[model samples]
Target: MSASTRSPKLRVATYNIRKSIGTDRRRRPERVLAVLRELDADVVAVQEVDRRFGDRSTALPPEVIAEETGYMPVRFGIRPESLGWHGNMLLVRRDTEVMSTQRIELPALEPRGAVLADLRVGGTAVRVIGMHLGLLGLWRKRQARAVLMCLEALEDPLPTVMMGDLNEWVMDGGCLKLFARHHHVAAPGPSFHSRRPMAALDRIITSLDLRVEAAGVHLSPKSRVASDHLPVWADIVPAGPTAAAERHHVAQSPLI
Candidate 1:
């Protein structure tokens, strides 16, 4: 697909797997993988990944997920606790090259954090950040603040694409504003309380600098039982340098 000067077309999504347990008293790997395949995201930020339980890392989470869905694992950051490796992960198309990646530990009741990955996709630099915040109210408030701090601390002002299981439920909340300054695209809809979704809890917001080429909430019958909350996502086409320069010229040049 040809990318325009303003935005490069891409498909991305976020999903929160509820520990892979579904209606069947079993963690059906096929079902889990199937749900993801349906979403069809070129890049994804997944939360609640179980790496190791009692001395064994999930032998093939990356490989299996990749093999089934074709999205390659770029980076995985396990939580501080060692018993079971529970944490966040970023996956991209196998063809995509990883430029850099890191874990961002935030202040909260639990050891919550985020993963910021710099990737080169088809000759374009895409900054992808995947984060899961605290569930508790007080802890979540603090965690939200910390999330804003991460955006403020970015090394470059280039357009950013963030995803993951952001624990916030309120649509008009302050956290949205923090992302707003960066130009998050309009939310597709809410994606929480999946058993019987009440409010649009799960969200897919993006930097205003990017365009919402496509967006949606995943709520398959299996996805609901797999996780308490549904996964929301957005396909973003970042504002390229050509567009940025034009905007700068508009800012500096007077009306003719």
Candidate 2:
């Protein structure tokens, strides 16, 4: 099969919903859901879906999200009331099959967490790491190293993606350097401080098995006010059997 005649494309996105609170200081779950509907991503890694205080319950209940967006949380009730662990959540389209889900603990100055989900996207196994790293640069670097170690321990190295609010300002150096060495850090443009939009805090890093065809920040009337960060999306095609064969063939060919 030719590159143009492959399976349907998959869209993955990451967003920090700010606990469903808009920049206007209104906690409206409906508005956040509206923006999500517009994004229409197949796999979504969300941060700040839960409140900071009290029981850390979900701002938008799982049931409400299911009914409104047809997106099911990868693993519901990580805590009795919380939809995710340490404000990191994963949502997949109803069609995607979940192979496994696990919570990752990191060395952090503050309470921070990451979620790893093994999913089947159009029959292709894909691994997703959703995380919100610490604030300080050094802490962020340590957190990134922890995440890399976790990925290394996986039994099967599937087409993996790591994404979410990394909170790192410098692009070339800082926390991204280690991960960028092995993974493709997507530059989806500036997505933070949704109103003015100056920094690219939210990011997606992928392994070589997946090819990013298109990527950008999703901005709109609802997104502008939905949260402090804008959602970032990427359209990717898995290196399936046909694509893999094509790659092998190219590598073996010596003559021009």
Candidate 3:
């Protein structure tokens, strides 16, 4: 395909917003939105969007996210009123078409879960999973294995992206090794402890079918103080002819 006809780059991000609480220990959803606007990702996997106890209602409610950043939160959680389960949330650009969504029940020492959203980006089907793994080394490995098992059970083999705070402070080894065997585990630089950032705990792993063009941590004045963990983003291009055709179709469609 010609350069002009090629599909535009798709930006994906994963952020552990710490429930919109900043380093100063203040809950500020507006600050979170400001950081997100600066990231400007097409799809974002967010962790800690809701409270851990009680009704589990949203900290950054869906309506607010929609109104502020023009992003639609993928609906999936045990609690109907909650934005996400285990504090994991996924958001897509308003233009994205969400085909289906579900929750992945993982066996862990603690209450751990994941959210999956099958979406159409430029009309190309892509499955995205947002999760927060367990803390223990053994549980973390089990959680990662369970996630891989869930992917293997899918009927169709579509391009998939797995993202969230893995909680793996050590970047080289640990549970991530299992994913590295099959997928491209992205290291978007250090994103943990938003104050003195040193660990690459947050990650964006992609299937072999997708092409990763760029990946990095979003460090800005607003992002630095928005939460305890910085946001990470990736620029990707869907592979194969279908992605190209769909992109052309989307581009040709009239603007609203």
- Tens-place lDDT digits, model 3, residues 1-256: 3323436677899999988889989999999998888988878999998888889888888878878986888877668778897888888877788988878988897789998989886655788999998888888888898888888777766778999999998786787887777677889999988888999999999876677889999998898899999999999876667654553453344312
Per-candidate Cα lDDT values, in order, are 0.64, 0.86, 0.84
| lDDT: the better of candidates 1 and 2 | 2
TM-scores of the candidates in the order shown: 0.80, 0.90, 0.89
Query: What's the CA error at residue 162 for candidate 3, in Å?
Result: 0.5
Candidate 1 lDDT by residue in tens digits, 48-90: 6653345434423665775788777765544332112246677
> For model 1, what is the alpha-carbon lDDT of residue 95?
71
Q: Residue 28: error of model 2 in Å?
A: 0.5
Runs off by more than 4 Å, candidate 3: 1-8, 239-256
Note the residue pairs that clash in candidate 2: none
Best model number under TM-score: 2
> Stretches of candidate 2 above 4 Å error?
1-8, 239-256
Score candidate 1 by TM-score against the native: 0.80
